[model samples]
Target chain A: MLDQAQPMDEHLGFEALYCAHSDAIYRFCLRLCGNPTLAEDLTQEVFVGALQGFHRLKNRSSAKTWLYRVALYRVRAHRSRHESRNVSLEGAAEPRSVSADAQYAMRLDLSQALATLSPAQREAFLLVKCQGLTCSEAASVLRIPVGTVKFRVHRAVNSLQSVLSDTPEASHEM
Target chain B: MRCSSVQRRLSTWANESHRPQEEHRVQVHLDSCEACRQYQSKVTRLDYLASEFKPVTLERDLLPNIERDGVRKGSGYVPRVFFARHWVAIGAAAVMILGATMSTRRGGAYSASAQEAVRGMESTELDRTAYHQSLWQAAGPHQEGQLELLDQVWYEAGKWREKSIPSFGGDRIFEFDKSSGLVRLSRDWRGKIISQEETSPRPKQIDLQEFCKQAGIEGAEANAEDLGTRTLNGVSVREISIPTYNLQRTLVWLIPGTNLPVRMERQNEQHGSWTTSWLFTIEYAKSWPPSIFDSSTLESTTGGPTARASQPFHDAESGTTNESRLSQRSKLPNRNQPAFRTGNIVFAAYLSTTKPGPIDSACASERVAAQLRRPLDSLASEYGTLQSYGSDSHDTDKDRAAGSKDQVYNLRFGNHPVRSVMSFTLGSDGVWKATSLKVASSATP
Candidate 1:
């Protein structure tokens, strides 16, 4: 039994942290891996790493941001490990669009457009656009310069526009 | 401003956070230049479209998954140095054993003494038994710390009751009624019952016989060895050692007369070091009253049934209380609704107009549906369907909040056959809203 006054109970604190941010982390992994099952596995693995390194976590304020950073690294490592087996990130399964509603269809079109962006751009775009992180924050998560994040987001937007324009509905809407 | 300057700042301008001077310059350029204006509009549209992509929800609650995989405190740690040298042999043997165990139905071998001991323990009947136990784990070199005490447990075959008195505060009682298939947990804070919850336990049977056999103890090919007799806690016991394919050494201390386990210890050899993984000591008792297992006794001993105020009353007709039943019914999707099948995934939506009664209201007097109608007829709507791989009936928890039921739903989309999930919860207004929706590629077929 651990002392209640201890700054943190390793298992319980990690469980609390997981409960608070697992959904966001799952969404991040889902977008990055393009496979829900793989994303789930990656999410579990990320937390396992978080548990092992919990004692070393210096600043608790940036736990969410720190988790994202860890997730990004794990995703990269997974891709690299699978790359030798001919498992391409883009080749991962795509989500099927069930609703024929124009809005739903357009969302699906945007998902496809997102897939066409470079991996770096996609990461930046997801952090800034999907995850609502600022450029500077995204840079910190990705361990890149703020300028690189901006450039990636800019390129991602441009590529998405170009790809979406190829479809008649998106072109007409624009 | 030059068209070149405006072109460079186009992204910044579209993001709507440009400096006032830059914004004015970009606006002037856009107003005057058709090409830049088209470019600016396209960027804005792209941003809008991207923002419209809903955040995906996980098909299942990940907390349980995390808890399942989460490392427990004081679990033995195996250094990487040890793993590097012996991991290959261990991994090969583990894979072979796991394959054999899963693929075949044949029982494994057990020593005659081990079998007799297990049979004796299983055959021994008791009206009720009470015992106290203290659990300990190794912290570091030269340190073994007390983890917890099983304070007390009243056991009667399928039904078992246990209470935990934490070091800091509060006492928790866990009662499992196997026949009823319900596990009730009540927590007492400073002698006041603070919280109580009832939930159905997962339908998994603990097969001790199968477990012993799988540990390479029972089968003809088993490598179980008798390490002679030893006295544990003043009781003379026979010691048996079983080495498993996973590099785990299991030491069982069995009483020859009763064939009951007095103490068991498991150690794992990894990376050239042996670490104690688990240790359990059992003390048996002959009898206790059947009434000891009742919740009423717990309440009387602790206090009055004050905690019952927080829980919904159980309904006799339906297993669930009326409050939970209405909540469940209010959330169920329309069965007549068409399911959307895209790729290997199928989706469905359920919308309801029912208003739930007040939380603590009696089942008979409360209107099942609300009297105050919403502007929209339907208060809630949910989209998603659970399609398990091979299970005939969809296994779902009735007491779970509307959208977050725990079940394995097939979520394969596009060419990738990954599992996906989507669920919703009902707000106070009786409107169903998706709590989570997620799709992931399956690692296994």
Candidate 2:
């Protein structure tokens, strides 16, 4: 139950900090990298960085948002080092209960559509939509203005709509 | 509002930050505009599709590992004190009953300093040494059934052999010897060999240095405390304890004269009582016979025929003995009775809270009903179906005294990656009841 307003104090140990934010930070990293394994590593790296600079965090209320900033920085650095590797949203295991054909088709179409988005748009869309971050919070994480985050998310949504609507399944369903 | 402006506002609309007047204005425009509504529908679908991919739950908690990393990096954050005393001597009878051999006397006689003993262990050459380690739950056997062997490994020089019955891997035996440089694997199902194969490009070799590093031998040496000598199975050995962070303790026993460790045990005091979580027994030998590394030996040991032709192993055709295939057929979960399936009831219990679904009345067992109600009560605000509950490892034991079936199922709660392992036990009447819920990973501070 760690909220933004929870102040950093002596009672809050490193273990508590991790449990509250680990899931959110991990999902954010996954959306950024599109790979679970890489997301896990980046999540670890981000926490390790947080541990080192924990005392320097003066704005305790923005702790969760600040952790996302660290994750963004680490993912950027990782992508630079492993430039040859491509971000893949494919290979995610579909749930057993879901309709295999329809789920698989939607997954394939969405994967292609997401791949078409620019890195900035993808980040903006993921933060606001997938990770459930507010535009202002996402803007802080992305180190951009709130207006810029809105613009990018707007463009990303429009682009995804255009690409996905082209699919036969989308046409039939809509 | 114009259509263009309304669309821009719609993009950030998911944040639900629109002013009341602006929202009404956008609603008016969207009501008249078919294009904007279509655009909104597609965007909503896109969001739904992208939400399908969740980050994989980590197999193990990273707190201890991250803490170790933080310590290594020498961060400014100072960790709290772990142990009150460096050297603590508990009653010998208690230790002996718990299967830890320690001196009976108040301060029994022991040779060699803790440093010397650790040095001997650190210097012990593992090049030609044979190593064997097995994991066992201390109280599990005494509580209900015999001790369960979670993992077993045998390694000598470049030769290695491992036999495990992980929930995912059923019963598997794998071996590799440097001379052959080939990995021989055999998988068994219900005491019968299902498949056997020779895989090339041998598994990675774990040298002595790497083994010691992984085991934190150096860390143990730094914090080693002598716990006096005791006779373990007629062997004269000295015991040393290393108290680590978080109330966890590691005890290592070494041969009195040789100073080579013969056993290492990890104990946790989380349940208000000390329990040996993992025990590693080591034995050193000059060399092992080639037959030990052979695949035929595995077949003979597991009591399964070496040739696949001898056994009728077809996944689709059950009752021939593949338990995995048999479980797959029990898909229809009966509400009045327990599902009798590995993962069905847990998901049913989880989903019962979110919305009306199967197993509402079928949750007859108080344990299962409590599990169903507890999540809903705690997570009242957030409600969602059980997204994914993949049981990676499953182990079942028969409690003859209690006349019940004990089972462990690993589950990952969606979005929140808490690795919750729920244990279920079936009573004599053949009713499945959840025995315990253990959270393998807790949120870190």
The number of the candidate with the highest DockQ is: 2
For candidate 2, the iRMS in Å is 13.7
**Winning model by lDDT:** 2
Backbone Cα, N, C clashes tallied per candidate: 27, 12
lDDT of 1 by residue, B366-438 (tens): 1211210110011110111111111001112231343333222332111223343434454577443334434
- Model 1: TM-score for chain B: 0.24
Give per-residue lDDT, candidate 2, residue B414.
28
**Which candidate comes out best when scored by TM-score?**
2
For candidate 1, the per-residue lDDT at B376 reads 8
Return the TM-score for each candidate structure. Answer: 0.36, 0.38
Error of model 2, residue B309, in angstroms: 64
Chain A TM-score for each of the predictions: 0.74, 0.73
lDDT of 1 by residue, A1-174 (tens): 111111212112344355446666888888888888999888887776666666555224355667889999999888887787885646434322233353334544676667766678888888776664657667889999987888877777665654565334321110
